[model samples]
Target: MNKFIKLAAAAAVAMSTGTAAWAADYNLTISSWTGPNHGINALMWPGLIEMIEEATDGKVTAEVKLGLAPPPAQMDLVMDGAADMTIIFHGYQPGRFVGTKLIELPGYEGNAEAASVAYWRVYEEHLAALDEHRGVKVMGLSTHGPGQIHSNKEVTSIADLDGLKTRLPGGVASDIGRELGMIGIQVPAPKVYETLASDAADAVAMPYEGRVGFKLTEVAENVYEMPGGFYRGSFAFLMSQETFDSLPEDLQKALDEKVFGEPASRMLGQAWDEIDRIGREATVEAESNTITIASEQDQMLYGQYADLITKQVLAELNAAGIDAEAAYEMVKAEMAAQ
Candidate 1:
């Protein structure tokens, strides 16, 4: 049988034997969709695995396997036990997620670290009842750095963005696109480089890390940055319920109390903040790339746009029986305190 089956069989037999002091070792498989060089692969996964190993006293660890499935299919992959763990971008699945949008709303004043910690707290306090991640065990919740407009087309003002064909990851970003008069093109994150390079899209809404992660620095050379960004992307570090349940009680408790939840969320968020900084540096160092900070007038205009989207999204959540407005307030407060 395969290594997973062999290990699982051993675990099952040990558990059945009721060896109270047995220390079972587990190697979890983490499915990832991004390129091998992306920070999620090169940095986040390794760091998380280290946290897991440390917390479990080396009894549990994980390795990331890329391209097991596409971005949208990650959650289902974990549910089906094809992968033990993975990260899913909530927006990629569209209507499948509602409470998750709490973290994606724009105008939250903080970097990804603060946002992620706040996300975890807010999720526990208010969103846990949503049970949106039904089958999988949620290991952590995080948001990437604020997403800005990256384009080959010049964007010096909000008005300049009108009529631009832009790639938008659905969520508040799509609402923002509609308000800004952008013609939205939907594509997975990995396809961004080719889409822009081939002139299929004039611009993309992504965090700064896309500069290096998706080669946006080479294709979408101009960055029209708003102070708080157009939106943040929501991501969940998820594990199969089967995989989590299969672990020894001690190992599970260690992971739950020490490595998972807020701790993992903070780590992932901080990593995004660091990668965003690196992406900013890459942009400055690139020959043709330019960053145009939104003018005061443009920032004001975008704020109005953000307000409208925020109201509509919260109303949708409220209709679905979530106290989204209260959760929204908590998110903002938590982020600020962080």
Candidate 2:
């Protein structure tokens, strides 16, 4: 009986050691600025965490924490190691990201998923030279659905966009705002509802998802949608290089194969598209809100501006030695194939 007890104790010790080792091979923390119910927090992060845990065979996992920092500060937070991972809207940091504008330019005629997947392909093939994301590891690149105008007042024609105090998410949205003669107020997505409610901005340019995610329908009450939209917003899912490098080699390989790059981008983009549909439905169901499709003439006028924006972006990219025109063509072709 004593011999049997000794063997059992050894077995228990071995099992305990194995369990402790497996419990947290890597514990990553994700910082998010958006509200808890935001689709990114509610849907995308959960799915991504599941993918990571599954791919790493439960040896790696992530947790989401809110209010670690504001949206604009998230990149710095991750870079400084205050957080292991976070997402940033490229537009929020004006001069910091140029290659990302390639995906934000208007006239890309596809859902966010296709555009995002194409964006990743274009980045890997051509725009990687820009090295815009120099400090952190870029896990995924994505664009929000096409952007529209949400306002307290009705906006039926392109002319109506002029002189409105509009909240534009920097980057290409600023260019589009200038072309439309809008007075630009720069704010992050989470601040949008308060900005509108306080009358700090009379209109906001965002994807349909913002209608619900930011609670715009409660405050704005009107949506003016141009075909394709004014411009899409670019975003980056970033991980700290230090944190990533600290992981076991096998876990890194698992993430690269199962969770990063194109797969992650595709997942995020699909979530955006799905949330956009939900936001639209919610807006339509709200009796106070009205949706207006831009007239054909108005769309054509916007299209002309889009062409100019495209040229300007390409020129900027070329000056940066990016072979912008070819990159643009590649994005279009890849989007088409998708």
List per-prediction Cα lDDT, in the order shown: 0.88, 0.87
Judging by lDDT against the true structure, name the best candidate: 1
Model 2: colliding residue pairs: none
The regions of model 1 sitting more than 4 angstroms off are 1-24
Clashes of each: 0, 0
Error of 1 at 312 (Å): 0.5
Candidate 1 per-residue lDDT, tens place, 137-157, comes to: 999999999999999989999
lDDT of 2 by residue, 1-53 (tens): 34224333433332232342348677788898887667777667766776788
Candidate 1, residue 124: how far the Cα is off, in Å = 0.3
lDDT of 1 at 186: 95
